[model samples]
Target: MSKPSLHQYYLSLIPNLVSELFFYIPKNEIRDDIIEKLDFLNTTNIFNTIYVVDYYKGPIEFKKGRDNTRLLLKDGDLDKNMFNLLEKKSEVPPHEFNYVLDKYFELAECLFYITNWMNTNINKMLPHDDTSSGIFYMQSLSYKKHFEILVKNFYPTKDIIPKGNFNALELIETYFPDIASQYHKPAHHPTEHTTPTPTNSVGVQEEIQPVLKKTKKPPLITALEAEKILLEQVFNVDFKKLK
Candidate 1:
């Protein structure tokens, strides 16, 4: 049988794992398949960036481009609407956008690992003292720094706080009680508590029925919260459990 194209393999692995974790597929069965495919792609250098390709135009648009470019254009020239049709035609549900984003980060991690390994091994193959061209040195340094940051920030071990024995969510709850509570609460409904109708009473007008101005809340706990929670949980101390 013909080998699957790199893009096909990547596209296939992501949707399923994303579906499994987010779409409620059985974890036990899909877990192995997900890991295996992710590993295969990693080992084979299949994934780099999540690219939305236009088969008609034969170019791939990296998702990162969305942040800086106008919604209508990416790479300064390509029209984003062309891809809008593909997005519309795509079978993936809109709700699964988060899943796709998570998978993209996962794939980026795998790419970082593979790229780091390649850079290290290739350096070993070259003479130690070889003073290469400026472009080569620049590229090497750039990639090395990229991999270093990726490994440092997203390392699996780093995810475990106290350097190893704690859940990130629990840590956040412990360290940032206020922030965590805010995140859990439903979005503040502005319409539910608009300014009270301007009262014409000369007196205090019954205090104007204090408009229950929705309290502004932080979105999430910081990384430090994760660390604090890890310590508390591991020691079996009541370090502020999340509501």
Candidate 2:
């Protein structure tokens, strides 16, 4: 038999990568049919874990960019358009599978970095009274532009690959448009505190109330659910039956 080319070799690593990624999920609780379905997905040669890693870099960098926009030397430099390194396929020599494998692991770690960052940021955002309180209005536009590039340049899978019923990209797309909107939305600061209400006969001062303005709520995300969606969609493994 002919040896596997670099493309086929990195392609083969996906199933093992996915297995390790979701090792915490209990195996016995999964339905036999689901297990069979996953096995079939494992057989697919089209999808790669690299695509999953590429999808996450923008969202991760978006938060980082907004947090320290002034400090950054250039826009969107945090992740450095890491996905672009993988752009050339036909140009890479078949014997360079080891190089590709190294990059795969690096991007894999990046994916985890992004996931953990989102978990932290979402938790912090949830308790805030103003969902868009600390958001940098100008910086989020740059972030939105980066996100647009990611969506437009996404690599296509092989022609025979089946469309996944669930997709992580779709979830990210849904969550971030609202995020972009939230950041772009005007911040309403109270111009002045209302005049204190008159006290009765007593010497106590009445509380002052400020005018209220309606604000849009930030999208709520569960870390576990996000991780599950990424695993199932990126790896093409159906986990609907995993209790």
What lDDT would candidate 2 get against the real structure? 0.35
Query: Cα RMSD (Å) per model?
Result: 20.2, 18.8
| Candidate 2 lDDT tens digits, 1-243 | 997666676565443333212112223333455545665434543221111122223212122223342323223342244233334334566446336634444334334433333333432433342323223222233333333333223322112112332233333334333333333445464332122221111111121111112444343344445445555545455677555
What TM-score, over all chains together, does every model reach? 0.23, 0.28
How well is each residue in 1-243 modelled by candidate 1, as lDDT tens digits?
997543453465432211101000112222343335443322532232222223233224333223321212221121122132235325556545434433434443332222223333333433343322222233223333332332222222322222222233342343323333544666566234222221121111112222123544443333334323322322233434332
Q: What is the Å distance of residue 109 in model 2 from its true position?
A: 14
Q: Which candidate tops lDDT?
A: 2
- In model 1, how many backbone clashes occur? 3
- What value of lDDT does candidate 1 attain over all alpha carbons? 0.30
